[model samples]
Target: MSTKPSLAVVERLYLADAMGAPLQARLRLSLCAGQGIVGDRHAGRRDWPGQNLTLVEAEEIENYCLSRSRPIDLALTRRNIVTRGVRLNSLVGRRFRIGDCLLYGIERCEPCRNLGQRLADETFDVPAVIHYWTGRGGLRADVLSDGAIRAGDKLEIVDTSGGLA
Candidate 1:
C-alpha cells in the first residue's frame, strides 16, 4: 500500500450560472454531499452524480498554453477548481479532502465538444486543445461531506489506494 499525501493547493475556483454560461471566479463556494456547488447550474442535477465538482491541474493549463504559444483562461476549462502540484489522475476512486469538504474521486473529467465550443476562438485550436488535454482534463468528484471550500485550500489524500485495500 502507498500513501499520496497532500501535495496541492486550490489556485482558483469557478462556478457558472447555467449550462452555457461563462464561469465566474469565486473566493469560496459551498458544497453539499450528492450535490454540486450551491448556485451552480449543475447543482442538484441527478444526471451527473460524480460531477458534484470538477478539478483541473494548473500545470495542464500551462502546458496547453505553452504548446499553443498562448495563454488560456482558467474559466474556459469549466472546472470548479484549478489546482497545482497534485497528480489528480492518481486520485481516481480515492477519497480526498479539499478544505472542509470530503470528496470521492469518481472519474476523469474528459474534454468534450461543448468545452471546445466554449473555448473556441481565433487563437484557440480545438483539435489541438483536445489532443493536448486528453487524459489531463481533470477529475470529477462526488461530494461525500458537505462543507465550504475556498481558494488556497490544500488537497489532502485521505485514501491513496481508493479503498482497494
Candidate 2:
C-alpha cells in the first residue's frame, strides 16, 4: 500500500516585513519551529491565535473576484500561503507538511474588519468584501518544524498512525 498522504499544492508564497507593508511574493519561506514564517509580519508573534501562519485557497479568491467583476491581486488576500486543490478548513486540528515544514492546523481564519478595510478601495467597498469572504477566508496554523517551504511544494497531512511491522 502506498504510504503517501492526501496532498495539495502550494501555489504562491507571500511575505512582508511589517504590518501594513505590501506583501511580496517569494519562491520560498523559512519556517521557524514554534515561531512563524521567517521575515513575515507575524514572525515571532505569539499573541494572536493561530498566528504562526495563514493559508487560503486560490480557487476561492478567484471565485470571489469573478463574482465581483474585479480581477484579484492575490497579495491583497493577506494570506501567507496561497494554495490550490485542498480544503484548508478541513485540515484544522490535523498535522500536515509543506515541503520540509510540519504544521498543525489551528482554526478557521475568520474574516475581520482589517481584511475588509484592506480589500476596500475605489474599486470596491469594505463591508461587502468582508461578508463575501465569510466562510471562505482561510486557515490558521501553528508551525511545528523548522524548514524551508517553497512555492509548488506539496502539502501532505502527516500520518499519526504508527506503521505495523
| Residue-wise C-alpha lDDT for candidate 1, range 1-107, written one tens digit per residue | 99886569999999998987878999999999888899998888878647688999998887776766766677658899999989888888999999999999888
Which sections of candidate 2 miss by over 4 Å? 1-7, 121-124, 159-165
Q: Please give the lDDT score at residue 149 for candidate 2.
A: 94
TM-score of each: 0.88, 0.88
Candidate 1 C-alpha error for residue 62, in Å: 1.1
Clashes (N, CA, C under 3 Å) per candidate: 0, 0
Total backbone collisions, model 2? 0
User: All models: lDDT?
Assistant: 0.85, 0.86
| Model 2, global lDDT | 0.86
Q: Give lDDT tens digits, candidate 2, residues 67-163.
A: 7777786665889999998888788878889999999888888799998997777767888878888878989999999999999999887854322
